[model samples]
Target chain A: MTMVAQTGANTGVQGNKTPDPAKRAASWRAVRRAAITIGLALATYELIARTGSFPRALLPTLPMIVRTLFAMLLDGSMLMHSLYTLYRVLFGFFLAMVVGIPLGILMARFRRVEQFFLPLVSALMPIPSFALVPLFMLWFGIGNLTTIIIVFYAATFPMIFNTWSGVRSVNPLWLRAAGAMGADEHKLFWKVIIPGASPFIITGMRQSFLRAWIAVVGAEMIAASNWGLGWVIFDAKEFLNADIMLASLAVIGFIGFAFERLVFGSLERNTVMRWGMMRSAKS
Target chain B: MPLIEVKDVSLAYDTPAGRVQGVLGATFNMEESEFLCLVGPSGCGKSTLLNIIAGFLTPTGGEILIGGKKVSGHGMDRGVVFQDFAQLFPWRTALGNVAFGLEMKGIGKEEREEIALQQLKLVKLEKFANSYPHHLSGGMQQRVAIARALAYNPAVLLMDEPFAALDAMTRDDMQRLLADVWKTTGKTIIYVTHNVAEAVYLADRVIVMTPHPGTVKAEIPITLPRPRDPLSVEFLDHQKQLLNYLGQGTSKAA
Candidate 1:
């Protein structure tokens, strides 16, 4: 009877099994949500257009924004500005990573270093990057340097904070296991600490990239010697070219979304998900 | 010389309230190739003692010697199987995880892979050589962890309730598999568990410890034959005796 009951239970579990149905349902839900949201947004726009409360000069139609975006693309100004902005963000992002990861590791491993940096990090973290734009412009004279400095300023804190937390949050058991296995300091850091902290570091990098991108736009608007997306928007604002301004804004949002989806999404999928650090929320 | 020796060892950790003693003046010795089980109530510092032997912690007092040399910290000579599911590195395959210790020791890749395969075969996990830890079940993961530790061919293998996480049938299977491996390798093992039947079934000598400033309370030799039946009268008697000892310890604490 016991053996039969066990067999019955096992068969029940086997029969009930379905592979990743939750993931399939989640994806379907997302598609449905997107369709509804986009449909409602278009209907609202049409309603506002018919009412004529929305001025063509101040808030151009979606079609006008698209047309303006296409024109800018054809003229090559959008590409040039995009490339400039990309250069500043990437350079500043890499700079923050190089400094932040090592500094975070130092802070995590050593008590004295953590104590010394705690005050400084706490003081600097709350100050927004926009506040540093004027100082950077004064120091570097309103060029790419000022914009890059602003991006760096915006990117550094999140990276530092996330990296430090990642390092600190590593399972103590892993460290103990490593130590029990005769892992040296170098091996411990590389094999255990770094791999353990990778998810948080990647998360930090993603956040820092977003912040730096915003800072670049803000800095470019304030210090407009360089041709960038922010500069295009600023120029359009002065000329009262609503289409161009809306087009630039659309391009910014699209690029930001694309970066998040294409770059960081793949990184998370390939590293954390593959390593079992995270379960797929889609499921 | 004894394979491993603990002389009046005591350990304490500093809590927010104050220093709390974990283990107190525990002494024991194990010969080479002996299977020793350390059994005690929960929070009696069985895990703490295991950690001290594994060189992951230092005792606040007393001394430990492995092959006549004082243990200072962790070394490759002592391999440990942690109680919790300490899966192999997620990034590495089963073969890679088992071969990691060898890789750290600078063994050639080909030789390490061959040895890793052999170890996996010993644990009946050869088919999972390329699988990641997450891809395997809890029992399979623990098997892989065991294979990884055994692949190094360490002088002593320390396990802290290695089978505590598995289902009953899986646990029984693991216990038998472990016995088979021990028979083949004859590696000195110090296993920690709270189960009396398991302790009697596996260990050459079962060392029981008391709680509240934990210390060794009794060491009983298992004279029962190998591949002993769980329902045997002798096994039941030993289990009853161990239970009595445990009950007395608890009552005293209360």
Candidate 2:
């Protein structure tokens, strides 16, 4: 088993021992850029607050939006809406993973199967989830199903494409080596193929999750039966409540950012970074 | 009885240019624990021969026998260390790469780790047990590759230009390391290389091959003592003779 560490160890002279200045600079630059961006945003908000031409109701100040957001939080509406959006996004994301990964692997491994599904995938891939809202409403009669379906539609493509590409891109040598070691087809798929393809699959999953979140919000705005962040923004639009709408927008952005950083970021760090497939520029 | 036998083996590939003969009616045998070197020019079917013995490629004609049984598909009985590093699984640690064979053998994790560590120590790479393949140099990678093969405890070791990519100093060190490992382990090895010096230094018998429908040109017995010096007159003479044989074969082909 060439998989063992003994043969893979470095017994000979070492090379490439330079200190990584790029990594240090990258983190410093990130912090500096973040500070500058925040400062500029605050400055813009202050400038808008000082202006008198725009109606205060239509263009509420950042402070006003924050105050409204705080009020909503205190009333439990913000928490409820946030939880509703999270549920839809998570449910859709998991559902997409369940359907997409195996399909992708099948497409990658079997050319005939890919050929059979090519037209269907190509047709469905480009059609926006929002574009399907009318058809979905006609079919499923408008509710959680419609929203979940939209999210599922938005998330499925990236997962399928990425997983397929990952499986296809596995080195032939690894397969040969595994075969030589007496790995059966099943073991080869589990041990060599899946692990080798995981980084790409995970990357695809992350992208799908982000897209699914966006699609869920769009779906909610168009077809929500009750409360969600998207519904809050849509409801505020009717009352001309710019503060509530802006606060909902900010919440959406924050949720997306947090999911990317906290979930996918840690996943990449622990797996690909530890495997040495990817290096974190930050460190 | 011979430990391994290749009887009238021939190989061909379906190329765009039609059937390209790789090895033509090649035959050889190896006694148990014998170190045999297969030396030839580029595209002389040296690698094809090794692959056939390793059961990676099926011969178009003839058969290979391992311990009197006909060779079938690839098995752990013959471990091949390919040229060009032959792709180390990037996700695995150095120890994990070496422990792969043990894992396949259904050895428990603790026992596999113990054997892998011992093998790493044998190759003087115990310090880099946690390191990945990309972090290691070409020579180090090949050393790990060699160690990976050895860890399988295969009946025969097939090496195809295993140290061809190393610098002169590293190559010499590897040659010495291989010799030490071979003497200690007493495993049968069939090494393939174009390097005459390496063939003379490492092999008990050097099998000279010619390209263009490859066939065995000569089987010169190496009568040198253990830890043979490359600078010695006897070694140089053998080296010269093998080089002359190769040169003559090439010219005749032309």
Candidate 3:
């Protein structure tokens, strides 16, 4: 009801406002260690580049990669490619959630739903999205449609399975308690079942998004989409632009990291952790 | 007429090990504003009988009637408190949990919150209304559960070993609190417990049950004064009498 204890919220704020010296010192040390590790790795790679083992075309220097990245960003090509990749992944991921969540709830609640879908889902889950890229291209043609479908296919399984497990694992005691308290079927599902199953549902979303991110890149590469990060990397390979390819790879990695940490992490904190259903590692 | 009637309720189910009779022809009638306790060892179906009264389960053969009407399923007339701490919805605060029944009955938010706060105050947990179930201790959580059950102003309260998980000291305190609440509300309570002392201390009448194909063994009326003393001679005599009934159960099996 949002009427959480004042002491709890106050303590949370106090913890951040007045961090103990020991914790501050420990955190600083971790930052220093990370910086040193990155510096050493980059120095080793620069040394190898100077020695020119294979060729500059095959293995560009760090500066060359950075220059290419900056050039792409300035010309707006990198942003456009990233936007395309983001759109496909988000679209497919949401579609999977819309279809998968209700389906999972149905499967958990009704035996007939499980019987009808279990075998089909089990059979399709093992098949990788990349394997279907060519088949989808032939059917739907090589474009956004094929890539989005592949992403949706890759993401839907985890969403459905995790949601099904979550609903099933909801404590039977809670269900009985709700029932005895005069909650009808509709109220019970919304008030008790959904909240109880939310921890698992959120976990499913996180896992499915990760799968969708991976599937989108692979699908884009194979389907030869003109605008995605995957397509840019694949296209750079043909022109022997090693720096451009590496730059695109870096963008993909950064976006994935941001979504995982910034988006999903905050979501977990706001819902499950706040509800006391889950504990945060840091807290 | 009795406020509640359990007319020869029998529940039998076919397990992989053949037929299992959970409760065989168990029957009882409870008066209005009476404090009744179902006492027995594990698997004696004391809890099962309580579930039947709460309408969580339907007896295979017989029926349970409340207020002269047969109970079809769970209803707002009877409120139930379970032993498990997980019974409270984790996402809701204590006030929210207490107000859940009222919400289901379509009460407005501000009014339900007012009623929930009053219930919490009755249980001496008004200050903790905003606390989540996980943040509360076992005793506190059980108190919140009690508050939640009582919030809807149900005609009857059915509790299944509600204080069994607490420490001895806390259990004693809860018993005293429960007696106070029962006196104030004057609602009929059918409590299930394994602790003989708890039954003797709190119940106006204790119904002792036995394990093998669980059935009611004896019903001993406790006529002790209000705020009954566990160390009192009369109370100890009552406990001893109940113990003998339970012993008869195991002895007959042997």
Which residues of candidate 1, in runs, are more than 4 Å off? A1-29, A46-55, B12-21, B247-254
Q: Which prediction has more favorable TM-score, 1 or 3?
A: 3
Candidate 2 stretches greater than 4 Å from native: A1-26, A280-283, B248-254
Error of 1 at B182 (Å): 1.0
Classified by CAPRI criteria, candidate 1 counts as: medium
**Worst lDDT 10-window in candidate 2 chain A:** A7-16
Q: Distance (Å) between predicted and true CA of A224, model 3? A: 4.0
Pairs of residues clashing in candidate 3: none
Q: Give the number of the best model, judged by lDDT.
A: 3
State the DockQ, from 0 to 1, for candidate 3. 0.73
In order, the Cα lDDT scores of the candidates are 0.84, 0.85, 0.88
Tens digits of per-residue lDDT, candidate 3, A1-283, equal 0212221232232132137887677656766876899899989988998797879998899999999999999999999999999999999999999999989999999999999999999999999999999999999998888888999999998899889998999999888888888889999899988899998888888888888999999999989667999999898889899999999999999999788756866777777777788764353
TM-score of 1: 0.90
lDDT of 1 by residue, B98-207 (tens): 88788778789999999999999999999999987788888888888888888888899999999998999999999999999999999999999988889989999999
Model 3, chain B: what is the TM-score? 0.96
Backbone clashes under 3 angstroms, per model: 0, 17, 0
